[model samples]
Target: MAGTELFGTIEMVDVFLAMAITIVIASFVSLYRGIEGPGIFNRIIAVNVIGTKTIVLLVLIGFIYERPDFFDIALLYAILNFIMTIAATRY
Candidate 1:
């Protein structure tokens, strides 16, 4: 209802969907970096970046679907991602 009818022909949901797709593509690039990075720290940072992207993608999906629950899930994932990154760095 918020983004709808604002683009004259294109909807806000479409915009959000496009953003989500773009994020996915960027995540793939991060994945490549994670696999082919020259150093372990680079790989770890790439993985962390991917995780951050995932959280954003999740939020966009939740907005597109009009589900507040997704926000909570994304927040939980963010916490887990942070913990994992810290543990990986410590190890």
Candidate 2:
């Protein structure tokens, strides 16, 4: 039991680290797309997609840290992102 628990803890840490790295990379890509995109709509779509990805990444990080409350934040972010995307598209 002790060994299994230790291994699980290490795995969680590894997952968290990997997610953090991915978030950084995604942010960079989002920035690049926003700056180099051909037009305004493309940049807006890229940013919206980045927002969704960020929410998922946050949820995964919360799980890794053993905190369920973070899921609530992720849910709220998803809702807000959806609303904003729709608004942006309509305008």
Candidate 3:
């Protein structure tokens, strides 16, 4: 039973790591879009998307590391991201 539980945990870790990596790669693409966007609207949207993805990555990291405290940080980041996007759009 212990071996089975350990195997399950390891699989969970692998899945979370894979998801984190995928989000990271997506963030890079979003960054490129922000940098080379055709206009201001496109750039702003791309940047917002990057911020959103980063939050997801953070949550995934917390899960992989078995750190529930990191969830608070993720929630804080999410709120900040939302406020920043609104502020940027207004600016």
Per-candidate TM vs. native? 0.92, 0.80, 0.84
Count of backbone collisions within predicted model 2:
0
Q: Which stretch of 10 consecutive residues in model 1 shows the poorest summed lDDT?
A: 1-10
Cα lDDT of model 2 by residue, 1-91, tens digit:
1122335457546756687788879888888988899998989988897898889788877767778899999999999999999999899
- Order the candidate numbers by TM-score, best to worst: 1, 3, 2
Query: Clashing pairs in model 3?
Result: none
The CA lDDT at 31 in model 2 is 83
What TM-score should be assigned to candidate 1?
A: 0.92
Tens-digit lDDT string for candidate 3 (57-90): 8888888887888889989999998998899988
Candidate 1 residues 11-52, lDDT tens each? 989989999999999999889989988989998899899999
Off by over 4 Å in 3: 1-10
How displaced is residue 18 in candidate 2, in Å?
A: 0.8
CA RMSD (A), model 1: 1.3
lDDT over C-alpha atoms for residue 43 of model 3: 86
Instruction: Specify the poorest-scoring 10-residue window by lDDT in model 2.
Output: 1-10
Compared with the true structure, the alpha-carbon lDDT of candidate 2 equals 0.81
